[model samples]
Target chain A: MAEETKGFSKEEEEWIKAQRAREAERQKRLSRRGGDDKNAVNINSLMDIMVIMLVFLLKSYGDDPLKVVDEDLKVPRSTAQLEPVDATVVTVTRRAILVDDDEAVPIREGRVDPSQKGSGGQSSMRIIPLLDRLNDAVEQRRAEAQLLGEDFTPEATIIADQMTPHRLVLEVLYTATEAQLNQFRFAIIRSTTESVGGIAEATPEI
Target chain B: MARRSREEIGQPDDPDLAPFMNLVIILIPMLLLSVVFLEVAVINVTMPLGGSTTKDTDEPPDERLDLSIALAPNGFYITAAGYQRPPIEGCPTQGPTICLEDDSVDVAERFEEARRLLAAGQDADGESVMEEGLQAYNFRELYNMLSGFKEDFPDESTVRLAADPDIPFALTVRVMDVSRYRLTESSYDTNEAFWSAEFATETAEDGEEQFANLFGDPAFAVVQ
Candidate 1:
């Protein structure tokens, strides 16, 4: 057999050159069109999607706090959606009485102070202690209102434990009523549809 | 020419909305749910009933208005004192067939008897005994006894709650809600901490439909 030619014949060479040119042209066309879409980031669309997701996630959550009565009777949950509009709040806890941030008077369970002692072995409710604190706060608020020329009185809201003795609660109410804080509102947890008798009724006369 | 035609068609270069749509569908529901959740109110309000010691002498002594709901460690005893007459000899001791224990008569029966007596008194006048029918009891009995008052004293405005020391706070609240009032007292001294809650008025127009609104519609706290 004759030795194989190292180079192509004229016809073969022409075909090879034409094929190379065609491939180069195709490659050039592809490059001009733009490279593969690998790293392009659609930031505007991404931001839009992120914002939508953020808003949707926010909507799914309930801002209302889970009202649970803990062992420590602190921060009672209220169903009255109305904000505590009353500037003055008198919070009576098992521990003590709190009025704004002035101070707290520790109330002992089952036993009251000597000042509340009645003639009978029954001790009077220790409301005097609470009233004194409240009165002082009211007086301060009144003076402030006078200085600022604002309208203010002892219009206060009372927050007390549902279990607090009626006697004690009465004392607080009597004291408040005496202070001319007739307009009052109570904070309660709205749960099941069960009746909470007698104590919650607000009879202006009583 | 083909590329130019394709460009004129305005087809988006990329086609992927999986993440975008997924985010929108999930996010929209969550935000709506959260806002609805925020609006709900959770309140546990205990209302009060009408009964007073001081006003006993002022009102006509027709029916036994003093309802004592004695709560013992084991069970409870509801004693009605101000009725025109005692319950028709409860349980009929040694009458026809057998005898029953004094406490064996169901409190429900007692309440029925009390209702019958009030109804009979109203029939006597042939108008309405709205003014006469009144019950003053403690929590457990008060809750059970309220319907009777509602039926007989439908037009009567208030009932009193005279609770004993043994009543639990939860039970007391239940009774107050049934009576539809929060017992509060008037203070002689504004500085005084303690006061008494009493039945101050009675009227025909004031009517309470729902137990929730038993206290005032505003739901004020009462102290005695």
Candidate 2:
């Protein structure tokens, strides 16, 4: 009977010892790798990439336009930073030059100065007709400002077609400046979702 | 230590980056798609009137060159505030944009040359065949003439550009370009550049690379 009791104790101890060994192996692994799971993958690289890209996009924001582009006018695209503001607007297209919707001058080599009498004398820098019109606009603006008790600033914006000759465009600018409308802004067409070169990158077909 | 060990023994480790990572992932693509790469620059021009009827008060003390450019049907009539030299004039009635009497340009040839210049890229050689075209105006001559003016007055910063009502707007911008920079033969690559004395001040950081900064300040004025 004593032999039988000793045999049962030995068998039970052997089974308990096997279970303790498995538990100790698991604790050793947990100490080496902490309580974290083995299947976890590191994404430090992806996070770093995301942070860099976010900073780059923040610097590319831009301002909005003062008015919609005229249907007849086609403005040039440039990487200029200044924005257009509310003011008297001039639209110069291939067909005609309009100052604040008033037909200021005809297209082509049409003379702003009607006096074609002088040859070697050299034409005066000022265009009388255009100046008179601009002065009228300036005076009107001054009167309105006086009524509102606001400071009067003579300003006008020119939206010229990119294809128009520099001389014609300059004339409009020169004319405006002569009339005391010196402050100005040139309109440009800038858009997102469109490449500046007007061409999209080709996608590879798999 | 014994209490902490007992508390943390069986807990699974977890990182709380779900909110931050999710935010970054969403923000990056939204901003990238809406990004506008096109730069829009505004050139500020102060036109000095020949005589202001509005106010006749304090005059500017600085004697900066009041050099003015008048765009005529024929060409440019360049003058100054205090008339020191007779106004320089050019541009023939029938020539390239700014015609000199000696210049003989066929409009058709210039058009053909421009077309060929574009197609040369698609050609096998792909070399830029024509470096420059005969502009409607003599921009090369304009550059040379303006360079002479710069040499005469080193301190002058502004030039009053006045154009005719009939002239094209591009000619004004081109004249502005030629006035400010010495265009290289390869400068045809860049169509327009904005520079005033302010350009020199802004770009002075990089001392090695040289840039053309002529009369950087451009004032657009009209003939009174």
Q: What is the Cα-based lDDT of residue B151 in candidate 1?
A: 46
Q: What is the C-alpha RMSD of each candidate to the true structure, in Å?
A: 17.4, 13.2
- In terms of docking quality, how is candidate 2 classified? acceptable
Worst lDDT 10-window in candidate 2 chain A:
A197-206
For B1-224, candidate 2 gives per-residue lDDT tens digits of 11333224666545578899999988888876665443444445565565322123365523445676666444456655455344234543343233432345443344344334323433212111111222433444455556666766676767777654434444455455556544343223222321111222224556665555676567764435
Give the per-residue Cα lDDT of candidate 1 at A206.
5
TM-score of each: 0.43, 0.43
Off by over 4 Å in 1: A1-71, A74-87, A101-103, A110-112, A115-122, A140-155, A194-206, B1-141, B165-168, B181-224
Q: Which candidate's DockQ is highest? A: 2
- Which regions of candidate 2 fall more than 4 Å away from where they truly are? A1-63, A66-71, A75-82, A96-151, A162-180, A188-206, B1-40, B51-66, B69-102, B106-141, B144-152, B162-166, B181-213, B220-224
- Residue range A111-164, candidate 1, lDDT tens digits: 345554333334443355566777787898899999999888557666665444
Cα deviation of A190, candidate 1, in Å: 0.5
